[model samples]
Target: MVEAVHTAVAGRVRYRVAGLKRAPELKKLLEFRLSRTPDVTHVSASDLTGTLLVCFNSGNTVEGLAGRIAAIVEEYRSHGGGLAPGDNPGKEAGWLDTVPGLTPAYEAIKGLFALGGEQPREPWHTLTPEEVLARFGTSPDTGLSAGRAREHLTTYGANLLPESQPRSSWEIFFGQFQSLPVALLGAAAGLSLLTGGVVDALLIAGVVVANAFIGYKTESEAEKTIRSLQTQVRPTALVIRDGRMSEISAAEVTLGDLVVLRPGTYVPADARVVAAHHLSVDESALTGESLAVTKTEQPLVGVDLPLGDRRNMAFLGTTVVRGRGSGVVVATGLRTAFGGISTQVREVGETKTPLQGRLDSFSRVIALAVLGVTALVVLLGLLAGEAPRTGSEYARRFTWARAAEL
Candidate 1:
């Protein structure tokens, strides 16, 4: 049983769980659960230590991750799942619903973190180039045939990002009104108009419009950062097709396609390096680290690897700065590492910082309190046979007098 810790260093933490070293099923459950969390990047159990280690994004706290682990432990116990190795833990597989909306496998996140310890040992990165080619049924020397390429194109779709379609100007403009406060203000405006407060309604409506417009303008400015990714693609790439070297638009590059890499070239899709002659690349576009990374056709070991350490793989939107190498396109489109960043940036509104979430909760509480107090005051006024009083000048003077009395 892992005791819950209130604090931990950001990004990485470890918990000691009894019998987990010998209980493979329990270990898998812990790894699968943590791997599904949006902020958690890596999870592994050390059979030697009876400990579960996790690495996550810096945006989340260690306390939250530890709580999740503790919750899993409690839920497993309450459901009569085994905590000891002799408890026949495999029978507890059906109890995974304790964590809402989580899938049993971690394959969805396998692509993003696979470059280093960010991902577990998936097939492509762990396999040699020849082995990868055999699995894809493509030739390392001739690449995919034109007919097979067409079939894979149908299977994988285009080599373009799907989740990150540019927000239209109108979408950006209208999306600004989708927040809770904005909805409440819109309701207030409607109520003001219905009550024959046209001037007051217009003033409130004007404020809403002005606020939305200012937001739209500010977002339009920020939209430029998303456009920067558009510039990262090289537009065209050289590939080996039909046993002959040819140049094609990067978008047409698909799964099983053998993309030739050289100096000053951009990788159009995520690929495994089959051959390399001193290959190095500028991966700053995806990782934000400017150091040029060397490429190789070697498999890396250890659960502590990061994306930057995945030297055997070449990711999309990264530039080849030195030497030459070729990688089999294992993943395409939004499945690439670069596409993962695009997806993250696109859905950032849903992944609120912890402080932002707390502030939003506090705002709702304050709003409800204000509404309840106003309703009580109106009830008291009506019962006393008096009208509900208003006027900011009276409110200000009355508040001061009450404060002095207190």
Candidate 2:
């Protein structure tokens, strides 16, 4: 039930529903339902704040609105289609977590962070080839001069997956303990030890160790496979450097260089097409979509278009499945659209998978619950005069030798 333990108003009314916190689906449902409510000017729900904030028409009473909210919550719970996704979800599994660079989750997480970038940059696809070239201070015919290319190369770094923040064996092992439930388990273990429950503490510690060890082993192997994949041959690209067409390692392709794309060749960097000879790219590797997206050199008119709709631009790492095109490299390396994109390498390392983000959020909820319950249990035990009797008060007649005996 959605009970409002607290309500306050300062233009927007806040309904504090502690139950909604940590439940992403519930938050979404509440926001969706409340947004359509009559006289409501704005509705916002935050899982982090555990509150439903609504700005209704000044004429409507807060109590009346909250009543409707409560009804909506109750009705949904009483209905058949109200269940959150995977209410029958399997046990938590990190065994299948992305190995960093070569998975769909890798792309998804990158897109999430990019879409949430601090300041969404203006779309490059809106500008014509001449404007795009002018913006980068380079030319289509001559490309970047050798000096300018070297300068941009230094600034943007290599056209490669950054090796920054490569987690160590120890880091991976300890990451298992980074969750909230594990933290609660640790606290419970400490309390058990302090209360002279040596056996209990040992058991709790063992569970924590076993969990971490298993996660460590699994993630270790996954990352090891990633490392092996990284060692494979780096692709090469044909580029015009200082007005001379030269073949270079894809990693050597820098910003503003003119890259010639042919069928079967992977797009080495995110580029704005200057010329297209009936180009159609297999963007499946990058977009997880069709093998054929027709490319165009003409400017596309749209606002925040999806990756697939940006026909005027080519993404890094996607393949040219048919025809040929030449583009001016706009962004290389981590800044490319293949995921893990930003203006800097640090942000790339900091980006987490959606699964990881959700898990972390859920863990916070579990930890809070554990803390509250632990405090309550202690309070009740103390009230009942069952304060823990440690070393001095232990008696052979009273104490059980085995934990199971208790």
Task: Report every candidate's CA lDDT.
Answer: 0.68, 0.68
Off-target runs (Cα >4 Å) in candidate 2 are: 1-148, 154-164, 178-211, 242-244, 285-288, 299-307, 333-406
Task: Evaluate model 2: give its lDDT.
Answer: 0.68
Please give, for residues 1-406, the per-residue lDDT of candidate 2 as tens digits: 4445444654567777645655555554565556556677666676655667777786677778878778756654554224455763562432113222222212222223212222124578998999878877787888888777666665556566655445888889888887667766676667667767677678877878997899999998887567545433346688887789865557667778889889988788889998999999988877789669999999988878898899989998788988887998877666677646434445444778899899788767765654565557657878999865654233211222222111
Point out where model 1 deviates above 4 Å: 1-122, 137-140, 165-204, 207-234, 298-306, 338-406
* Angstrom error at residue 40, model 1: 46
Clashes of each: 2, 0
Q: Name the best candidate (by lDDT).
A: 1
- Candidate 2 positional error at 221, Å: 3.0
What's model 1's TM-score?
A: 0.48
Per-candidate Cα RMSD to the true structure, in Å, reads: 21.7, 21.4
